[model samples]
Target: MRREIPLLITGIVGIVFVLQYFIPHFPFNRMNAWFSDWFSIVAAFAIWLGALNLMKISFQKVFRRKSDWGYAVVIIMSFLLMAVVGFAEGKGFRDQGTAFDWLFQFVYTPLSATMFAILAFFVASASYRAFRARNFEATLLLLAAFLVMLGRVPTGDVLTGFMPEGMRLSAVASWIMNFPQTAGQRAIMIGIALGLVSTSLRIILGIERSHLGGGD
Candidate 1:
């Protein structure tokens, strides 16, 4: 029963949204907006549920001595600390004064920047792994990727001293980004759109209920 009700509701909501792209009538538009607002409220409740699940899982890990559970402790602590400071201080970010502001600006911002900066290293590592030459196609992909990366920086100009006239270095880079690259991106987007449509049709018709908990 717990699983069935939510699945039914989700199916109905997904169908309505899919219809909305084709039907631009007032009823569809209004219904879509109301449904979106309702979804947002429900999403907030789901966030609370997620926070509860996180706390439970982290506590279980601490009890069992799972590998690197201390990191989970840090994750849970950071969320709780931010929640406490935000609520206990005042209302929205506007009213949230001095100390909270300092914490948000300095502490949270620096940690977030550093965390995202670490992703550059991971991206470089992944590019290395993915760029290995196994065949002609793979070699071409690797070469193109190297060109794109080089063209993003001053390195391209240094290496390609024969850069053509009337095309500034940045303009050459912009052409690479805008023309063939964007066309490829558009093609990929079209494929993604089709996949989304098929998956959504499946969900709307009750072919997918995996998001619901195991049935009792």
Candidate 2:
């Protein structure tokens, strides 16, 4: 009964939502809106539950003085600090000059920018190793990347200065992106949508019950 009840709820909700897309009648729209509100409430609770779990684990690690527990302490401290400032200041916490806003603008933004800048170097190193041109496909990929990168900078114009404007590397790069890249992306999006529909149907039919934790 435990597993059966969840399966029944899942099937009903899925079917109703699917019908709402096609029907779009007044009653169905109202029901869909109600269900969406319920989902929002559930999502809020889920986030709280996740935060509580994180706090519990961090507390345990800190209490036991485990390896790298200092980072766990930092996480808890940051979470609590943010929450306290946000609650005490109410909507003003989001306004400029508030502690919360200062932390976000100065501390978080700079840290994020620094991390991304460091990551760019790592990505370039990885790309250099991957583009070794050991095989025909690798050589083609390496050349494509080289053209794209070069065309994105001023150096490409200097290198192609002798060529006609229409025959420049930047023009070729633009064509590659607008045609081949766009087509590839559209194909991937279609594949993703089809996969989503198939999985949703399986869950709605109760054929996929791995989400129920443990069941036949």
Candidate 3:
């Protein structure tokens, strides 16, 4: 019964949204807008659900004194601290000079930046391995990466000054980005769209029920 009900709702909502895209009539458009607004309200509730789940797991870890429980304690405390500041300050909590804003700007942003900076080194190492000229395809990829990197700097432009303006490295880079990059991006987007449609169909047909939880 639980699975059937979810599948029925999924099928109905999926069909409605699919039709709404093609049929731009009054009722369809209005219904789509209404659903979107409802989605926002549902999202707020989902956030609270996520926070509660986090708290529950963190508290369990801390109480059990599991490995890395200190981090779990920190997570719970941070969540509570943020919630307290946000509630105490109300709507103005997000404005500059508020405790929430200061923590986000000084603490959150810097930590995020540090994480990304660390990731850059790992990405560089992976790229080096991937770009090794082991075969024709790999060699071609290596050359393309080199050209793109070189074209992004002033040195490449200066070195290629003798060539015609359109044939310069930077000009070639611009052309490659505008045409090849955009085409590749569109192909990926199309694949993602098709995948989403397939997954939605599976859920609507009750073939996928993982979202309803395990041991079904």
Tell me, by TM-score, which candidate is best: 2
lDDT of 2 by residue, 1-216 (tens): 999999999999999989988887888878878998999999998999999999999999999999999999999999999889889889778999898998889988998999989998999899999999999989988998898888878888789989999778888788778888899899999999999999999999999999899758
48: Cα error in model 1, Å: 1.9
**Between which residue pairs do clashes occur in model 1?**
none
Q: What tens-digit string does per-residue lDDT give for candidate 1 at 39-114?
A: 8999998998989998999988877989999988897788788778777777664355556787888898898999
Give the C-alpha lDDT of model 2: 0.91
Off by over 4 Å in 2: 30-32
Task: Provide the TM-score for each candidate, comma-separated.
Answer: 0.74, 0.86, 0.83
Each candidate's number of clashing pairs is 0, 0, 0
Model 2 pairs in collision: none
Ranking by lDDT: 2, 3, 1
**Candidate 2 worst ten-residue window by lDDT:** 166-175
* Residue 204, model 1, lDDT: 82
lDDT (CA) for every model shown?
0.79, 0.91, 0.89
